[model samples]
Target: MNEALHVVCPHCDAVNRIPSARQGAGPKCGQCHRALFAGEPLELTTANFRRHLERNDIPFLVDFWAPWCGPCKMMAPQFRQAAGDLEPTVRLAKVNTEAEPGLGQQFGIRSIPTLALFRGGREVARQAGAMGAADIVRWTRGQV
Candidate 1:
């Protein structure tokens, strides 16, 4: 028997039920018909954060960052690379702390470029500071 996984659509914010075995087969969203995994970090805001968190059966690696922070800007490419290396096992996303201050405050993100891993709708691991793509992949693999 194959278990179905709930994957949130990156393009339309729709929920898709995908079989675990076929995850690597490139599943499409039932609602918008878009690919489930986009090989890059999804831009998350207050409107879609909860839905993505609560809906996705896979773990989410979220970069809590701000626009003006140099470290965050530097780490963006690394995070984007990590997304390609990490999925379709894990979901990568970014949250702009400047635009979504409430989410940052709620997560107690005192620093920019914080990496938080969420599983089952709750944060399981967190890290602060900039890291390379290899480091991010290693750290996330260890945590999840």
Candidate 2:
């Protein structure tokens, strides 16, 4: 029997079971009928952060950022490109610290453009600073 993996839908926040072999085959959400991996970072809010962290079986890379931070703004596109390169295997997301101060505090994010990697509902690795897409991909691959 093929193993199934739990994937949280970025659009609707619903969890779905996907065949492990078909993870890269572009699965759609059963609840919202939207593509599971959109090749872009999902905007994580206080309301859905825990769900995404706990539900996804794959590694979750969250960029803890703020709108007013220049480095965060500069890293946005690189992070987005990294998402395209890492999706279906690693789920990339962004948390705006300005909007979700509690989450920032919970994660102890003292700086903007911090990258936190979570697996099995817990943080495994983190890096603070801005990096290019290749660097992000390389770092994530090494860690996970």
Candidate 3:
């Protein structure tokens, strides 16, 4: 029997149970009826960050960034591209530290573009720098 995975919807933040085999088959959110993986990084805020971090059965990669930081701005495109390359299997998201300062403080994000990878509600790996799309994918894959 195939295992079931808990996937939080990017559109409505609803939790959906997806069978492992059908994850790549373009699953939709049960509540919102929207595509689960939209080939882009989900914008996470204080309201929904904890839910996604604790609920997703798959690995979650979060890019902690701020608007005015030059490195964060430079890495935004790379992170977006990495989301496309890593989605469905891995959930990619971005948290703007300027807007969600509390979350930044909670996570102890000292850098502007820190990449944190979480699995099963805990951090598995962390990278404190900007990276290209390939490196992001490679590093994340290596971690999980």
Q: What is the C-alpha lDDT of each candidate?
A: 0.96, 0.96, 0.95
Error of 2 at 11 (Å): 0.3
Q: Compute the lDDT of residue 115 as modeled in candidate 3.
A: 98
* TM-score per candidate: 0.99, 0.98, 0.98
What residue pairs clash in candidate 2, if any at all?
Answer: none
What digit string (tens of lDDT, one per residue) describes model 3 on residues 1-144?
999999999989999999999999999999999999988999999999999999999999999999999999999999999989998899999999999999999999998799999999999999999899999999999999
The C-alpha stretches of model 3 lying farther than 4 A from their native spots are none
lDDT of 3: 0.95
Residue by residue across 37-57, what tens digits does model 2's lDDT show? 999999999999999999999
Clashing pairs in 1: none
What lDDT score is found at residue 143 in candidate 3? 97
User: How close is each model in CA RMSD to the real structure?
Assistant: 0.5, 0.6, 0.6
Q: Candidate 1 on 10-84: residue-level lDDT in tens?
A: 999999999999998889999988899979999999999999999999999999999999999999999999999
